[model samples]
Target chain A: MACMNEDGQWIVLMGLLTALGLFFLALIINQSALVGQTTAEGVLEFPKNDIRDLRSEIFDVYDSYGTLHAQGRLGDVEEDIIRISLERKNAVVHFGNDTPQDVSGRDLHPVTIHYNNGVTEYDEIVYY
Target chain B: MVNDSGQLYTMEGVAAGVIMLLTAYIVISTTSIYTPGDTHIPDMQLEQLGSDVLAMMDTPDREGGTSQLVGFVKNGTETCGGNDLRNEFLTNCKMRAGDEDTKLRAQVYLSYRRTDGTVNTTPLSLPDPEFTGRENAVRVTRWVQLDGILPGIPDIEHSSRPRAVLVEVLLWRA
Candidate 1:
């Protein structure tokens, strides 16, 4: 009687372990399937507005410079504007009117413009 | 008596193990093989629309001048023709009528190059449309404007001047 009871308990224990293992396996599989579906859906939605925003910010910087030129607060009238370039996201405004006196006087000027992206950079020139 | 009970219990354990194994196998196989259907539209249409708008700006009538581009994509089930799309774009972008009475929503701004050798920038604002004409669609609008600067500085003046033109493009589903 004792031996029979011991064998019965062992069999029940094995059955219980098997059931638990299968349950965990099913859970893992279901979670993986859900993740895969979400990733695929996100890929299809092309965010067009994001691209447009970046392009717009680039133009905003240009408009600010144009406004300053029309205002006449930038430099001397007779001074010839040499090369104007936007480098390192900063505006590089060069002038041909740099006199020896102006260079020695350390009158180098700097102006900062704020773009739509909140990027602020200075426009400066080095006299030769 | 003991032998008979032991055999019965052993058989029950084997049956349970078999059931568990089969369930685990089914789960694993289905999880690995299943895939969602493809539903994403490519960028070809949008790119083409942008190019066409850019081409229009180069026309003598349009004259690639300084201007802003703004519009939005409406979500609905309706198909939009050229005229309808243009009207919607103009309304959302806040474009004005040109001398020829052409409702101009998208504008191009010409400006000097930045220090990085790229063109200067303008600010853009996009408005959403009230009515979406297509299902699962989104409205996108952009407003672009030239940047202004301080006066009297020749370098700064020329730098701030419009050199390269900005072309704003708007599009919708056909």
Candidate 2:
């Protein structure tokens, strides 16, 4: 081994470095592609539209039928919502409104809504 | 040392390799790489557009005014008002900047609670004549608050109590 010169060794070393650099670049590209995939998957998985639609639907209930409570016919309607949400949406939902409270010289009902579908949980309290 | 003549060749190879790597990086960075998400892209777009249409239909043109969606639901399946809703929805969906999208179509359904305490879904619009049952469709729902008796629905018994109903639209491209 001592008879051989080591002058071309640097060339071999540089070729190895070049190969490593290219591998790193490929890895970086793969990581970037992963980023894009997660973004789209995240948007589709979270039921943003479903939650918003539920909120609006609850508000619509309040608009048509006065203040809601846990008793009488209004309670039955609320039960309908909860049961249907669980069945069709694969989500558990509960919502109700109490007697109107004075807000800025106006009487508005205090409504509360709770929703959970395993992945996400949401709670909302609004006056209508 | 020994054989310094090959040093120039080594230097040229190193330069070429570095240049190629840098060029590749620049080119890749400039263009977008859509991986694993292209399959869901069309579904995402259709869902967004469908939701937008439902939201717009439910929105009142002016403050403290009734929306067209509510009016159609109140008219029920027995009347021509439901037909109007279908027409309006299709027209809105097909309308675009460049040209009308005739391939887009929709069917409407109403979900209501029965007296026995179960939810029931009834079709407000008939099934599409061209529907082969294999087309991919997105269902978008909006809540409609109906006042008093559901006079139009033959199945449901009339009750004086107000109620909330779900209006669902299934959109697809033929």
Models 1 onward score TM values of 0.30, 0.78
Docking class of 1: incorrect
Chain B alone, TM-score of each model? 0.28, 0.82
Scored by lDDT, the top model is: 2
Superposition error at A44 for model 1 (Å): 10
Badly placed stretches (over 4 Å) of model 1 are A1-14, A33-52, A60-64, A67-128, B1-134, B139-174
* Per-residue lDDT over A1-128 for candidate 2, one digit per residue giving the tens place of the 0 to 100 score: 46667677776767786786878688767766664566666877788888999998887777656354432567666776776677667889988788899999999999999999999899988999
Docking outcome class, model 2: acceptable
What is candidate 1's lDDT per residue for B1-174, written digit by digit as tens?
Answer: 224446666778777776777777666766544433322222333343444443333223444443222111111112332234445444543333543324233322222344444344332223334324343332232322333342321233344433222223434332
* Model number with the top DockQ: 2
Worst 10 residues of 1 chain B by lDDT: B69-78
lDDT value for model 1: 0.37
lDDT of 1 at B149: 45
Estimate every model's Cα lDDT from 0 to 1: 0.37, 0.76
